[model samples]
Target: MTAKPTLAVVGATGAVGAVLLQILSQRADIWGEIRLIASPRSAGRKLAVRGAEVEVTALSEDAFAGVDVALFEVPDEVAAAWAPVAVARGAVVVDNSAAFRLDPDVPLVVPEVNAHTVRTRPRGIVANPHCTTLTMIVALGALHAEFGLRELVVSSYQAVSGAGRAGVAALRAQLSLVAGTELGTGPGDVRRAVGDDTGPFPEPVALNVVPWAGSLREDGWSSEEMTVRDETRKILGLPRLPVAVTCVRVPVVTTHSLTVHARFQGEVSVDGAREILATAPGVVLCDDPAAGEFPTPADVVGTDPTWVGRVRRALDDPAALELFVCGDNLRKGAALNTAQIAELIAAEPA
Candidate 1:
């Protein structure tokens, strides 16, 4: 490794990819060459990074030749096919897709939780956790380190942006159509208003919430729900931790919020929980209900750290704690985390 590494941002034209570019430019400099790669349609387009214009190149085998680190933000299928090619070309791939997250050989990492695992990547690839899991696990992982977490019951209020640009556009269009109308008053009114414009959601996400995200699985759990369970376990190193999750799509444009009830092996307290989160890396403690303080998607959008509030210990259960957390699904949940991981790799000893 050198003092500065050549970096490649794959899928540089998508939502997360655009955010990743902004994050890279805003952060400190540790990269040599920053290459932008996208599909043929986006090739030759100019994107501003680090205060300079960079031309997007079509993703190809030659694109990875001199790339020391490749940060992928493409679809699962695209990543599954191209990541190995990048790795074969000698670039360590930090993929932000689900394709390799559960692969035993690939390290699914959150730098705040399991950064040391970065060096043990047997396949020269690291997987970023799902945006929902990334949203809450920073604070949860901090508390788990102290209280020894045993189980989790979590419900997520996710924004439309989690589904990408189309999700955002659909929500905006529906909101506009129903802005001054009476849609939420009757059943199917909102759906009828936003006809054929639901975008990536199964139903209208304006003036109402959908209790589903991701594809339905055989076990009745949405793929989004299952990701929260599985990714939390992997990141926390607890395979049998007993996690239950329900994912809901809210009308918000960005940020994902979660209400978590965590059970620990030992007794816990509200003050202790507050103290841990106040000092935890990648966490911001914003709990003060008297002054009307709590983490909300409105307050967390475009932010970096995971905002945690409403910290309380279960009244009847001394070994349990309850809290609310919010994170920008596009920032810490995806882009910044991968950027941090790539920086970690850049700092590795030569």
Candidate 2:
């Protein structure tokens, strides 16, 4: 039997944070005492865990004093500021932010692929891949192992939830407006007017798709696009991995889906990728286009694994593989991944 480990969940009131708390409660065998920490605004809020409620406390420098593992589900700035502090105090930090994903010392881990990186805690801080990279790697990692992946051309149909809790609210608000007046904004939902409609993005996300996911980088690529490209290399340990990513925000509220076309170094049959995805950890295969059975965001919400379906061999190109994948952005995409990292680290003393 594995020894239970003391856990501290930072940002316990956020969207992904709440899911982390729930997943932890569901897996009691992997946890000991659990501490829920959030911002001062959310401090003292009560959240249920294992059928009982726990108080959410404001995270401080001393929050990690006696913790064995700390799962960070907050924004990058919060993780950047507190992750090192927690590590210094003694806890291993599993961060679900983009802050340290590209840090040379930090191992951006996807448990299904390079979980060994989590075991070797050289930096005391480990990164969970971006929600997009998280699902893409699960579907592709098996193929990368069976036949080395050389290039990836990915176009993501990401759910609003991928942007965090705010993204969810934005979608619902816009949907209500569109449903009422065919994309007419009401006076009441002011947030939908200013920021979402060409404010945060160049155009409104109501009943439409936004080509950008994150803020612009100096290189013209959005931050979300860069994350998908960089984090894939980190998890797959393939530096110089050719990846072209276009991230778009869809109207859905929970699951994020990706259409990936990968060119491999060696020959890979579609049947081979199918067989590998069937048994791969953290992946659920659903490729049956003829029978109308394929993974969909509607079916993937609340599920823990990345659902891969719509598998096909590329037309006019044998080495190129095309597939569709969807995973709950709030679950497997963010919170569950963080909790799983903490669970894995807890199994062995950090």
Candidate 3:
């Protein structure tokens, strides 16, 4: 048998990094050495992976030496700077950031949808799609494979954890302040309770929904919304696919839910879509209206697969189908996808 490859987990101390560690532990052990790399402050910390404690080394040029594959869960800037370093040091990088998702030389990968794109990476880096895109793409990909997707209109109900640890902390703090109080009914009531600590969000995310996620882009479009459009098209190999998106930040902790209005090339039936979703890899169909069975963030959190529900053909348009989908943003949205891509690279014959 070929020698097992060495693996490096960059940003091994962040929120997604923590979840990645758990996933690495639970999955099949395909690596020989699992090297943990974090920032300087986190260098000495020992994190558990594959049932063993591994000391985190601070991010540096030498850290990628002798590593076959490196999984990166750092910020865009950090990834933009360090991913290339890892690649230069002979490590194939699977980065979970927005840094290289749009790079023509790099492949934006979702294992269930675009696994074949992994081998064509000329930049030696595979980019993971946005969490919002990942939440719905698997189910959409399955339906598209059958009916041929033409257009997409999606609205995401994102969780606080999508913004990282500070977002989660902000929601908890705001909830604690407004828990026993008679707020949220009057004007500026929740704001008064939340004070100035909105964390990464522009407005109070407790007892509120902000119709914004990423920074402002052209024509009032948010970066998050544009990411959904661009990444979806890139992953599905549809360059001119019409995609309109509106991203909202909700009060949930981990899971992200989206209401997708997909229009196919031809008439689509609810039964057909349901069958595709139910049997598709990495998708779980839970659509039963009369019994009040639908995937919700609370129930979908900590799960791996995309939980899809509310499957119905549009009443007015035979070409359109409306569905609700949920996924743990930190799991399939980030770490698991990165890990899956790395595993794909590992599976290649040396």
The C-alpha lDDT values of all candidates are 0.93, 0.82, 0.94
lDDT of 1 by residue, 73-151 (tens): 9999999999999999999999999999988899988989989888989999999999999999889989999989998
Predicted model with the maximum lDDT: 3
TM-score of 3: 0.99
Model 3 Cα lDDT, one tens digit per residue, 62-151: 999999999999999999999999999999999999999999999999999989999998988999998999999999999999999999
Each candidate's root-mean-square deviation in Å? 0.8, 3.1, 0.9
What lDDT tens digits, residue by residue, belong to model 2 across residues 58-157? 8898777788888888889989999999999988899988898898888887777888887666789998889988867887998898889999999998
Q: For model 1, what is the alpha-carbon lDDT of residue 304?
A: 98
Model 3 gets an lDDT of: 0.94
Which of 1 and 2 is the better model by lDDT? 1
In angstroms, how far off is 44's CA in candidate 3?
0.4
The superposed Cα distance between candidate 1 and the true structure at residue 43, in angstroms, equals 0.7
Clashes of each: 0, 0, 0
